[model samples]
Target: MTSTGTLSRAQGTALCVGAVLGTGVISMPALAADVAGPASLLAWLALIVLSAPLAGTFAALGARYPDGGGVSTYVRLAFGARAAAAVGWCFFFAVPLGAPAAAAFAGGYVADILGGGHTTMVGTFLVILGLVVTMNWFGLRISGRAQLWLTGTLAALLVVTVVAALPHARPANLTPFAPYGWAGVGAAAAVLVWGFAGWEAVSSLSGEYRDPRRDVPRATAAAVLVVGVLYLAVAAASVLVLGPALGDSPAPLADLLAAGVGGPVRVVTAVVAVLLTIGAVNAYLAGASRLGAALARDGALPARPVRTPRRSLMVVTAGSLVSVTLPISLHTSMLLVTGCFTLVYVLGTAAALKLLPPGWARRGAALAFVATLGLLVLNGRPALLSLVVAAAAVAYASRSTSPKIRIPSSSSAGSIAPKPNTNPVESLP
Candidate 1:
């Protein structure tokens, strides 16, 4: 097959930006504010600073080793197949389970605007899910142009929201800064991780860049700058303009808009929320489908009569639908998903430590590794979900490679020492 690099530097930057932007932007500021008051801005800053090295490390790896296998490939190269499979499974399952939670974020906005409460939210979820599944079914339904437009729309909306809201800012909002105390800032930072969750995804696109060695770094730098400035701007404006009420605003951005421009902005905010949700879920499902196919091809997953991206996508979408029906709270589901992605970040950065050439890049990877490790710890008991998923992947790989035996068969040459299966899945899963 002839391969041509189709993504320009601008395109790559947009992709990275979108990856890191996430659905959290709609609500994170308020959630963090609730946890830390105006001091949550510090958490926003901490996350932004952390993103520099984290994004750069992945960009460096992507430039050096451009492959479809992405972080999983890097992991396989650094630590062998089992670890790679574990990483793959973490991503594959993370998506669908996370999907309902992601979609519901938008649903809340819709319900706020349309007034059907839970019914409205659930209806919105179904519509978004249906759109995403359709978009992914024939292969990635969103064109690059569509994604570019999506990013543009979001960037524009955020800018307008912040700029409009800034004039309303009051110094009194910052008077006591840490009303919840310094411990609250830490709590806020923990909540903010969702906003910064997708930088590691930059690796998957490295192979698509026109000149990855040169462009990956540039794109990543651009993305980090944009993401940092935009996110901080929104968060700061939320605190400064909305003051004490910021924490209680379900649609914080809309509230900012109303406070700034006054009247009837919920509809616009709801539309933005829907667009953001679609883009996020689309990206997750698209990437996971491809990952599933790759995993099956490599033998980490069970072989199907037909192993294709569509098949993988369906399985993932199905899981997402089932997750929506489950009795779990959206908050708990998100935590579960966050745990999986966090573990992926941990493993990806650890892999980068082995794969990158020495000096700044390797050092950056170390920094990312430590940050992500701390995040995993912050996840507390929810993080145990990642461990379980990883273990399942390893077990599946083991089953594929070696047959179970009765007693301790002295035949080490057989199942006991069998060669390992090397492929794994979505892990958007």
Candidate 2:
């Protein structure tokens, strides 16, 4: 793997875009349409608008202190070991659930075209999990480059699909938009959380960028624009082109293409889904593996076999297997996965609010914190369970934070101090 500062802005942007796109783009349109009808488009727009401040908060922190540990590092800088461990736990545990959810969303598309049910889905999940783990094993430079290529191809196909489908969109479909009322909009927003999440993925790779300060924010900005337009276009097309049928569509993008091109292009959307899922899961595996290793080095957990990050990867793989057993569909699984990352966002944004100076930056962070918290609640009981996990992790970590085990100068990301510093927080690195 290349050392820190080796990645260019283009690579950084690819990481961000790949991380943000994923299963959500492929499946969320139908799910949100089911929840809020055409008004789901509003939920799509709202989250895209909110993504700016939320992404900026993490981007600002990454620019200041580039680290592989990402949001966990920012937490350590602001709140010390306990909170940091908890955020790390949230992220670490999220991978297993999110990976399976991502895999399943794409698998659903494949199953639809082939007719094999969960058996096909399980096979798809296993193949995807194995492929991404293997890709990540080679190292980030390869993975990041793969992301750039994957996203480039995914973006081109998506742009073509949206443009071709736009001619089929009818304004009449937008009428009776709020058929389910405003509450439905909120419900739709909760589902869209999966779609909007992923800004922090780039933060975890911040140190790898050629210039974190210059590249990370530029990457984030470019990703925001890319994801925002693509998502809104797809969401709008699903509503206006498919209308009531949008909610029931197993493969909305394919259906949209079929409407425009006069035949099913299951092959087209399915290919996009597979490529997007690979990039998304690969990016998460890379970030989570590094954060896991950093946690081990800092004594948040026990060390494992050699330099392979084998333990963390195994945990994620096993967790995905277990997740497959749950009696949930892709849409529900997305909500549960979104809850996990929303918890991470809440912590990171809260940390920024606490650590940043009293100014627009901090205010933006505060807004993000409140928005994420709202989304967290919308996630319902799943979010509460995540909080319980965090509380337990914090209590356990408190006992392990001995003076000698404190973060060392050589740690790749955020390091916990042995004792809390009473001086101004600016003294922290």
> What are the per-model numbers of colliding residue pairs?
12, 0
Per-residue lDDT for 210 in model 2?
70
Query: For candidate 1, lDDT tens digit of each residue in 1-429?
Result: 112456677777776776678687888888899989999999899889999998888787777766555676667668867887898889888878988888788899999978998888889989988887775554321434456678888999999989988999999998689998998988787677777877765565566566767888898999899889999999999999999998898889889888888888899999998988777776676567666655665566775721566677778877887888889987678778888988999999999897776899899899999999998887778889999999998888776762321221221111111211112222222
Tell me the tens digit of each residue's lDDT in model 2 across 244-278.
88999888888988888877689778878888888
Worst 10-residue lDDT window for candidate 2 reads 420-429
Point out where model 1 deviates above 4 Å. 1-5, 138-142, 402-429
TM-score for all predictions?
0.89, 0.91
Which residue pairs in model 2 clash with each other?
none
